[model samples]
Target: MKIKEIQDEIVEEFSHFEDWKEKYEYLIELGNSIELIDKQNKIDSNLIKGCQSKLWLYAELQNDKIIYTADSEAIITKGIAAILLRVFSNQTAKDILNSDIKYIEAIGLKEHLSPTRANGLVSMIRQIKYYALALNTN
Candidate 1:
């Protein structure tokens, strides 16, 4: 599915939850669904810059698409990163570049975050996009 479709689905899914706590719980459940990145790929250089918590993202080009794996030290941030990876990973470079991530707010995430976390989200998005660009270049 497209990124917007994925965001819409997330919004639809979380809208049923009454509060941030429930929403956070759902996000954690979602995060748990993703496979862990192997130790070999969890290098420090792939870590996201500007995040208050340590966040690592690794991407590889496979069959002309980018496949991403990410992890974070914080649960909430890890959930956010997992959401992003689900939407962007396994997509073509052009698809990743063209995706509109603003729907994150529509899902009631970024606005609820602290200023630092909000900035970290933006930085994470930029880093993910940069990985897509790098894959395209290669």
Candidate 2:
């Protein structure tokens, strides 16, 4: 699906939950459902900086699309990365770079998160963009 479409779906999903607790449970579920990153790829180089928890992001280009795989020591952080990957994975580099993930605000994710996790979310986004930028010219 297109990034906007996927994001809208996420917003819709979040709307069903009336409270933060349910949102958090969904985040944990998302995190658990994420495909595991290769153990080898979970190296220092893949670790995103600025996150209080260890978050590793790995990406590669295949058939002109970028594939993202990530794992975080923190469940919420992992879920946050999963949300981003849901929008970005298997997408073209340009699409990933140009897409605006408004679902963050739509779902009030940042406000609901601890300040540290919020910063981690931002770092995760930066890492995804950096990967797209580096791979776009290839």
Off by over 4 Å in 2: 112-119
Candidate 1 residue-wise lDDT, 42-102, digit = tens: 8888887888788788888899988888787777777887788888888889889988877
**Number of clashes in model 2?**
0
What lDDT does each candidate get? 0.78, 0.86
TM-score of each: 0.89, 0.92
The most accurate candidate by lDDT is 2
Positional deviation of residue 5's Cα in model 2 after best superposition, in angstroms: 0.6
On residues 72-129, what C-alpha lDDT tens digit does candidate 2 reach at each position? Answer: 9989878888888898999999988999867888987856344454447777787789
In angstroms, the error of model 2 at 44 is 0.7
True lDDT of residue 23, candidate 2: 90
